[model samples]
Target: MPNVTIYTTMMCPYCFRAKKLLTQKGVKFDEIDVGTDPGLRREMTTRSNGGQTVPQIFIGKRHVGGCDELFALEARGELDAALQAA
Candidate 1:
């Protein structure tokens, strides 16, 4: 599996949902809590190309946007392939 990362805040429901899905799929992800750190939040924005929202996800070097996009990938049956990609 490719390296997975998710930038999130503690109170974000979307973050929780996104994480739940990943856990269900047996994906191990690096969770960065950007709720209290401006520097980390800025990093997330830069990494996500101005996506200033919680749960900005990355599978390897590919920016997968937020929770909606993640779920959308699963709906299309492409998420597993993406995760398994090198």
Candidate 2:
């Protein structure tokens, strides 16, 4: 399984959706909650190339962008390949 990491915040639907998709794929992920951690948020921004969003996802060091992008990967039938990239 790939090393999945997701920077998330509470009450964000996009974050929820991202988690749901990952769960449906049965992949374990490290979920960093930046809701109350400014430092983690900054880290997330740095990892995501200044993307300061609620759900900044990374799969095995690969920056996968946010929820919409993730779904786009699934639409393109590439999500499974990404998960296997670890």
Residue pairs with colliding backbones in model 1 are none
TM-score of 1: 0.99
Please give the distance, in angstroms, between residue 9's alpha carbon in candidate 1 and its true position after superposition.
0.2
Clashing pairs in 2: none
Worst 10 residues of 2 by lDDT: 77-86
Task: Give one digit per residue, the lDDT tens place, for model 2 in 1-86.
Answer: 87999999999999999999999989899999999989999999999999998799999889999999999999999999989875
TM-score of 2: 0.97
Using TM-score as the measure, the top candidate is 1
lDDT of each model, Cα atoms only? 0.98, 0.94
- Put down candidate 1 lDDT per residue, 21-72, tens digits, no spaces: 9999999999999999999999999999999999999999999999999999
RMSD, every candidate, angstroms:
0.3, 0.7
Regions of candidate 2 where Cα sits further than 4 Å from its true position: none
Best candidate (score: lDDT): 1
* Stretches > 4 Å off in candidate 1: none
